[model samples]
Target: MASPVDTPRNSPSPSPEPDNPYPVETVLTVPKFKRGWAKGARMAFFEARVPDYTSARAKGPAQTADYLVAVSNAYCQQFTWWLDPPNEPTASDLAKTDDELDPAELQLKAAKILRLRRASRNLLDRLSNSAPAISKMTPAQIKRDPVSSLISAIANGKTHVPRARTAYQLWSKSQFNKDIKTDVDQSVIDNGVDAKSGRIRLVTGSTQQAFQNLPASERRVWELQADAEKAANQEARGLQKKDGVIPAMPLDPTATQDMLDALVHKIDPLLQGISKLTNGNAHFYWAGPEPRRGGQINVISMHAGVDRMPIPCGFMEAGGSEGVARRRTVEAAIGDFALSCYDPKVQAARTLPKIAPCSAPPSFLRYRPTTWDAGNTESPSAHSQPSTDNGLISPPDVSLPGNPTTSSNQSPSATTSKKSSKKRKSNTDAAAPPAKRHATGVRTNTNDEDQTSDDEPEETPWQVDDDGSGEDEPANSQPRRSGTRTSMRISTKTLPPQHDPLDDITNTVHMSSSDKLPSPEIPDNVAGAQLTDDDTMNEGLDTLNAPTTPATASTPVSTAPFLSNPTIPADLPKYLTHVLPKFETLAEPAWQDVTKSFVKYEVSRKFDDVRLQTGNRPAAAVQWSRLRRPLITPDKLPREMPQTVKLAAEAFWRWWRHLQPSWRNVNASANALGDIDRNITEEDWERLDASGANGLVNVMGYLWLWGMKVGVSGEGCQDWEAALRDVQWALEKMTAATNV
Candidate 1:
């Protein structure tokens, strides 16, 4: 997904709209930052409605050059300031601003702004004059050109271009390789192989073999050293460490001349792949400082094609953990983007399949019984039996609601006999104990013989009893006649109720007495078989009228109102306790006044500390005495203020009250009545003289009190308490200071 920062709010159209009066005016908006510019820029340049190459070419070289210069200037202005403002400019000073400013500062700022414009013009002229030759030249030819590199740096912030020569230098001078050479030379010397006497060859014969057969412990040490070196190298390359593992280089070989040559050979194909993907319009370059941290290689476009603005295609990390699973390079990142554009199947293959909200019904519900055997017309037994295939009671054969019986399945006489059989079976089941009743199947009773009687109306299957049981048999239900065959048949359409209707019917049967039948055990596999039509209809109605759960004590609630208990803390100072409850209902304007007064009180305290440290120096003593009056006058305060400021003010009051005894003791020592002031240092006095002590103390006290009230703990509360302690210690030390 693309972020809002990367997408352009408004894009330009190639041709004017039918209602638009002007046709030539075209406007494009680009983001000021480059963090999410890759994906956004690609959408703006390629996906947006813009003119084709033929239309752009018709504008001619002169118009194109002017457009390039305008875009380049706009890009440069975001990061660069063209003019320096004069310092301390008054009405009179503004008239002579040039004379007041340093000449060197003016020249440096002007040169940078002009440099970008000049390079852009130079690039246009170079391309226009050598159009045919430039078209034939490879990507290497354009990259090596000075103009291409200069414009790329200005437009897309591409600073570093990787080279095979640089890679070779990095490997040759690496500390790990130097250590390996040292170990090989030391091994040869320890083995009594005299190289100076020419007794044994040192370069490749015995010494090389000894280096290859290094011990397991020594090899492990080298591997650890290599990992450390790789981490440091990646840090220098501006890549972040992932999962505590530094990204590995494309080719990492042990310290050997042969391995080093192979490492250089592997890099050539990677560089070529990057060049081929970008062609000549853009270059794959590292976009950051020379020794930058936390950055990646980006494919920066030069705006040489149909694109009006210089945009990056995408970026990729330089290295990953060494092995079969290496991180993607710049070539792969660009290739993926290109393939997604050309191949529709690639995107289709990556998309996840959609899933249904609810799962399919169980296999038992899908079971449809075959037609009954006509040759042997034996009636079903007294109770319905469970099917061997699935652990569910076989449903009785009956016509479903809104579904008429077909001639092929039922004859006129056969239909009447089935209805009579169901009516008799329902009465027998109702009289039987609930323990014997099957809980997984729904039973429906129908009687055509009862329909003719006007006095007792025929009962419908949808009717519910007075006790809310839908299983109540008709009031005129009859017992089964002897030798009557009852063929049990289940309708494949309707499902059973969630709670057994038989339980409710059994409870209705014994309503007068407290005794009830025990529920029959159901098989674990067919537990869901009891979801009948009546339960489903009731559930649908309940869903429409269901009430939502209300908020409970365990749920998190907002504390924005700043309401708290009326009772004040016992440790709180008596002078401020009366005003503590007012903070809960404080207004915004009065809270600002309290903050200002607290700042003044803190400033006054600093001056008083300076007076004690200077041994009653007249200048310091006068300043302290002047500012001491009206320092947080409690009676003059407003009726209400913010709770945070109130807590902070109260803390300052308590802290001052606590320091009173120490202040008196320090004052006595300074008057030559004690030796406490003798231990004070000049550094302690200097620290006390620093400003902003008032704001620091106020903030720390507020945080400490707020954390306690809100039940904040862990490192967060500990940090605030630690800061408060440091402030208290500093103030105590200031009180004990003597003349310097």
Candidate 2:
């Protein structure tokens, strides 16, 4: 079975459209820079696009360059300034007037054309610099060659070539294609020479012969140009034009390596440290919503992996948002992005966070509250005062919310008398049973009045032994609080609902009532076996009434009973060795079962029809749910299920899915190692748990179902052929179960 990851080395070539021999021209539209602040960058970019062009390679060497001159004239004539200069009325007579032109739009159009022309000049210059043969010629000599003009026009965006009709198509995979092979044979190409004109003219010849006439240096230049165009076309496939980012004003191509280094350090201080730590180079890069004028420019740490990948430090800049403000915003966003990468649960939405104004600290710098209880410490605040027997502190008398205000006419003596009376009432209420007062949700002694002083204990303190023993002793033998707080009656209606359908179906564990209770403390007297018979009986009764503790999730469960018994023979089957690795890894009985299951799945598959039924997904899902329920439900799981079995089962299930055939054979479709369909993308896999693809169950639930049937040790056991066969059988079973 071929997975989606298996892509064809050579994709089918698109059929060619009818060719137009004549020159085709269309109106070119230029867009205006809507942003006011990016005007400086825009102008700089346009200036960089203007070229100092020469016609060295455009004309013949001695008679001078008529063809080269014509090509240059044609290139310049496309722009408005060349056709209709503002300074000359004669030049403007045929051109669009000011009323017909948009100033911003016209300016942008000129800049774009200038940039494209400059790009072509740079390409030629680079080729000349690299080849000594070409370098020896002067700019004038090179520009006189007709080949240079045509190549430049293409790079400058003045001309376009359909990719399907490119000359390179005649060269690639030439060994496998006769047409491409014949196209490159120079001897075969010379047969078409026109005797009288001394010009080459051929019929039924390869497209590559058109370029074979050029000098070696010039031919190499055309090859490089075509290669670049081909690469751009490949990269643009399956992507929309809007997806691309036009980088902020590009750095000067003439800048020295050292200058770039200096620029990087100036922009980001953190990258300097990162470079030293990683023992790799650091450079500036950009990542944002887009690579246009307002896109973020940040320093990325480039360290060597199998290949180099930039590890960016959070830093960014936009138009008019440079210097300190951009750095801070980038830092904040990068912090969260880095931390999220470290988290195992943070797999959703892998796109980088967008930069914006931010005051929040990065993850590493953010304030985090310590969860440790301060009251447990040996500090003075922890044990300031001794607690009372009733667990109530009789506070100093204070005016209650219900009390009437003292009149202004009253003297200080009268106010003092009222406070004294309130104190007496508070003391009386404190003496009453705690159960009665707690039920009323009210206190006679006000909260402010009950505040303990710095010298008093707030909570009961444990006693340290005077003899310097390391252990703590019970403090003053105070009776400990125990049992459920039953005094206050809780309405059933007020309590949140207990039965959640998701939790029940997914087999999620919830804390039982007893699990929520505080563990009962054993008194020092009980440790010494000083409990009376009645005390022993009461303790036994409490233990009996307590809810059972749920099984520990980490503890390994054996899977022998659930799986078919392994068949361990004197000579083990080759497939068994592949899946199990070492025979000793599984017990004799378990190995037998592993062998048996493999045999069962393989032999049974031959009789089963393996037709794919994509539209019957609902029926397959229903059958899958029924099959998986026993393995997933905690109570119904086999007692012998072990961790090893679970891992092996998971690997097996994933391997099976990867073997499933693709439904659609598009360029973007490739199967993943564990995907049931070729359509699932990396993004879909990340959110598989959240998506209800399997109807009622999630990925975890499905894994758990298979996991309970088999277990093993180490990473995971795999049998490529076995898994493939199992998938074939599974598809058949699924179809039968669906009655399709």
Candidate 1: where is the Cα deviation over 4 Å?
A: 1-147, 150-557, 560-720, 725-740
Tens-digit lDDT track of model 1 for 552-621:
1011122212112132112221111112222212333333334333333333344231211211111111
Instruction: For candidate 1, report its TM-score.
Output: 0.17
Best by TM-score: 1
Q: Model 1: number of clashes?
A: 11
In model 2, the Cα lDDT at residue 397 comes to 15
Residue 369 lDDT, candidate 1, scale 0-100 = 20
Q: lDDT of all the models against the reference?
A: 0.27, 0.28
Q: Model 2 segments beyond 4 Å from truth?
A: 1-289, 292-303, 306-740
Worst 10 residues of 1 by lDDT: 316-325
